[model samples]
Target: MVEADASWRDESLGARVRVALWLRDEVGEGGVFSKASMREAIKGTEQVDRRMRDLRPAGWAILTYRDKPSLQPDQLYLEKIGLPVWRAEHRAAGLRQISAKTRRYVYERDGHMCRRCGISAAEQYADEPGTHARLTLGHVNPHISGGGANAEDLITECARCNETVKHLTGVQMTKEQVWDRMKELPVQGKRQLLAWVKTDFRPLSPAEKVWGMYRQLPAAVREGLEDDLEALMRS
Candidate 1:
């Protein structure tokens, strides 16, 4: 077992490691605390909640009201601390280690785009201009315990979609906002979206598949091909 060599108050350690340290020191096993309190302690850092969720894979047993009905919605119970993440050896405790080959295969298989949103690498979001999407690999089911690092078990996702899919924090869009956008879709678009929703998979169209392939090309080559495609269409 690794002993606590550093204090949670140390700002230099990673956010996840500091969070583990904070929980260990401030909220020991069986201690109860609120999200606000945790955030207040770990000031100036973002995604404290997400960091807490990351500890679960390491064997941290934190529970919310949903898990323990007796607790208030704002309160969390620390059932157990699973790892001594403060130690160098356990720094990556409970995290999946994917092979380089597996990562490349998964990214290529998903067309180097976010499988959930179909946004290619370095593409800006329609709703959020100036924010380019950064792609990453996520488990097909983020909540699954001990999910494997196999290609079949992984999916390409943007950082935003990854956190949202993991239920790590609040989504950018609310239900009402999403419903409003859904209502604006054309009839055919609505039908297609419905089909995709039913299966929880959006099959890439021929054009999208080719677009993914084209996006993988070098920037200069992609620019040349863009002109070529336009010319070919005109021809």
Candidate 2:
């Protein structure tokens, strides 16, 4: 009976909850461990990497080699563990299952572009050159508790920006710095800025909305449509 009762201490819990427990019990904070060790500890679970990534929005601060160059490629460091997903109260933390309908609505509402950086699906960032953006829904406030699956609570975010916002290195431009740049804008630019700020979102123009949808087409279809649009414009 005691053996069977200890399931929460092991696999009877959700994979993510067990993963959090295993990390807390085994690794502690600021400890480094390899993927092999984690998989061994949490055997029979698929997408262990994904479950680990899911913990981040709950404010767990796991770091990779990308975040900390001292670590090996296959290694991950547990900087801080956030929610105790093993507990009943917090099990739902960071695990909002966004429905397909709501997902589509949020994407369309945001013009199918990442709200954080305005990068459309599969478009390369101007600064990052050659790296393409992959769009995903992110919480309006990722670090907050109970970030639900509701459309109003989510924003379209590219994978890159989503990860950056989760980590939040705390060294971005200050408000004064941004305001100084905003002050440089002309009257029309200032008006456009006011519209976005007032609505707390960037409203897509009709042409831009069409472009956002057009960008989602397959490469060959997009190329053909590009030609078709050009020809129709000339006629």
Candidate 3:
């Protein structure tokens, strides 16, 4: 993945070409171009949006809010041109999806620290407030395990804590067992784990895990699970 703010350029024609070259290098021919995907690839939303706009009618790309790629070039062109420049500017200005907002909110709610390993956002953001940080927004209950995307279902954790929890609890424990083990963790760890009780955290096993936990539910319940989780994960 490209590092955030990899470069700073004056948003000019030459700058746009350079950005396109960077995209060509990073994404290659098979890669699909979209606002979100390019934002991720280039690591600068403003840069990507500006480059896209400046190159418009020439190098057009399209993506759904869900991040899915659109194959129709005409639709892509239409959508890109239809959007107001200011809206794209706002998106490039750091206004992220609902999920990103939720993730940051969860991190702040947890005192801007990793509840599992005790890593703080202060330490992660020491050099730059918005720079990449060691702390991650972890799902207290993973989506694969039937977790929702609600504030009550997530927490801030260091990479270590997030990975450890996933590895330790993913397939080895039952939902109840996972809860039991959570009680034995540190205070922060417990705080992280407790966030999942209100949401479903099904274990990864039989296909029923997905079908039953998600599909078989009532429409409202299923919609809640689906929509909320999507919002939280920014998926």
Best by lDDT: 1
Full-model lDDT for every candidate = 0.84, 0.82, 0.48
Better of 1 and 2 by TM-score: 2
Q: Per-residue lDDT tens digits of candidate 3, residues 1-235?
A: 2223333332332344445454545544445444565555555345566455344323234232223334543222223322222322422321112387787677556665566645443243344555433566666654232245678767777655664554342354477996777778999867655665455331233543344234324557767887888999995
Hey, what RMSD does candidate 3 come out at?
18.6
Instruction: Arrange candidates, best lDDT first.
Output: 1, 2, 3
Per residue, candidate 1 scores C-alpha lDDT tens digits across 127-162 of: 999998888899986777567888888999998898
Q: List the residue pairs that clash in candidate 3.
A: 145-202, 149-229
Give candidate 3 regions above 4 Å deviation: 1-98, 122-133, 143-146, 170-235
Q: With candidate 3 superimposed using the best TM-score fit, by how many Å does residue 147's alpha carbon deviate from the native?
A: 2.2
Count of backbone clashes for each model?
0, 0, 2
**RMSD after CA superposition, every candidate:** 5.9, 4.4, 18.6
lDDT of 2 by residue, 64-118 (tens): 7777889998888999989776666766777789899999999899898888888
- Please give the range of 10 consecutive residues that has the lowest summed lDDT in model 2: 1-10
